[model samples]
Target: MSDDELGSHYTDVPGQRVVAAALRAAYAWSVRDVHRNAAMLEIARMTGVVMEAHGPGRGPVTPLELVGVLRASLGSLLAGVRGRPAELADVVLLDHEGRLTENAYDLVCEHVVPLKDVVGSRPWLPSWTTMHSDQIRQQVFTAMIASTKQDEYVASRRFLVEHPAGDEQELVELKDRAGGVRLAKGGYRDVPEDQLYRAPNGKGWWWPCAECRWPMAVASSGKVRCRYRPHSAVFDLVPGDRPVLRRRDGARRSSPPAGRPAEGAKCVDAGVWRFVVVPGASELRIAAAAEHAGAKVLLWPFLDRFDLLVEAGDEKFSVDVKECLSLSSLIERLRRRRPSARILLPRSCEWQLETLQDALPELAVLTETKFLGQVRSAMRKAR
Candidate 1:
């Protein structure tokens, strides 16, 4: 056979010229959205977060599995750097399908990051190898500390053990960290140290760096509580799970229809939009579409998951509950409505009220708590 013909046949043979094309394709398309949501839903369900509301489908997790998440998210993002290396595109992908074993840590250290040849003491961003589960947990920890500088549980037990409750020393440390504390080692911190130090599982973290929310490990009177300070660059230093980014105050304003696109923008990289509507079409739909013709199947099937959906009488509150619930019984309910609908997941519960609106409206959304606050205020006003 000719060179071209022989080459084609050889590649088609399995396990010979094996190219991880599927994995590579996944990498290329792996934007932060779903990959991130998948990791969150996976862990939230597993940890039974906030009283196992995610249901029995998610069981308890061991320490090893926690470490795996830290490594995966970090390693994946870092990709092939000597400090954080991995198998597939750098860092392993962990699916929270079961109650993972702690042994997963041993597996990660041995299999995932086999070579610990640290070339320089440079700080690494939380690479993709950073564990997803751990990353989300850390983000939760970070957000908590960011909002409330004192993580009560961790503080009372860990730091308070040393500083004691009502101790002047603890309060002083807390004051310095709301804007983040300056470590003797280097860098100014931003997170609320008091919040992180008091969290339920808050042990290893040091001063809460607002920018990084990583518990900064500080050694002063000669003690390293969080020995993994430098490595925080490689692991879950902070809760990097991007919930949603809020533009700075005064950044947004009322727009008149098709406000402003940008200074100079290209069609292919619409930069901010998912799909663009062709200008003059009343109801635009792509047929043989342009270069980037893609399709999406949003699984939002509104159904009877709406518990106590008082059509009348009860004027308290109601949820436009989408069918992708966190319970097994809800799964059954979804199946009943499977023929007619799909589940709609907001980027987060925070986006619940706005998810149903026009995606292209260019409007700011409120938090879930904000909606609840409105409900409470309305009740008080009525009373």
Candidate 2:
């Protein structure tokens, strides 16, 4: 792949040509056994994925099929036919999690490998632009959007036919109100044109959407390109080096007793419900003054490390932090009624939850499920 050839296909950004050339170089290095043109393309495609998903300043978010695909990519032993190689299936895998035993990897000769390899190879920029044809790339994206709601649609692979040129395969387009394929600009690598065809004039998906989901890609730029959202209001942005920490939500609320005036600090030991102050209680005084009585203390952690998971008596108060992002105002109001609860958060982040934890040194960062399980186990033991 030459820079001039790629620059011609991509007409948007002039400066991007240099970026594209650099990406191709990285891609060329990633594939060691490239002998011919087709094999080279396949390797580039894989490299494009690595660039997109794990690119700089981006979360290495794994896609659903990634683990399985990675195993296949790694364990694939190839037979040298001429200069290129062919893969043979002589591998078996185990799923220790038992979630999906079909795809797992075992090392040390005893380690079970997944049926297929779906692992990260590296990150690259604008992966789609590198495909053999623009239409194939567009179709891949068409199916990806369907993957967003995998149940709703599959790519019209059944009705697919060889392109009029007899060189490429084409999946039909998804027609909106107008007669053309309708695709959202964001996350889609496809550009619309006469090549965008529809199945039976817009009926079915020729291929399964789930398989074609393009979660990330390399940029035509030297850097891998992934979805970039605005800095969440919850995160505080600052200038140069260390970012300032701030809360997107309100300060956490941990009330000792909603209706209390028990003289001073009272230490009641009753079991799991035998919740006593570990140490810090600046908020206790606030509760005594009736400032933050029953407000819930929600701890938001990085990658959902420690959620607001707890159980008090017969009532359960654990809420997955990620799910809380989708809650309505009324539900949030109702959740605040919980009095006195411990919220574990990431040692990092300036979310109000962390601030609350700072105010309450007794709060712990529940790092593992075992620690979380122990809390519940203690509560059960107390019961």
Say which candidate scores most in TM-score. Answer: 1
**Alpha-carbon RMSD to native, per candidate:** 23.2, 25.5
Give per-residue lDDT, candidate 2, residue 135: 28
TM-score list, all predictions: 0.19, 0.18
lDDT of 2 by residue, 1-383 (tens): 34344234433321122122222322333332333454354344544443443344332123313333333322221111121111112322212221111111011111111111233223331232132122233433354345443222221211111110111112222222213232323322232111111223332111101111111111122111111111112222221222122233534432111111111211111010000111011112222222122223332122122334344344444433211111121132224333233332211211334334454455432322333445455556656
- Point out the worst 10-residue segment of candidate 1 by lDDT: 271-280
Residue-wise C-alpha lDDT for candidate 1, range 115-137, written one tens digit per residue: 11211111221211221221222
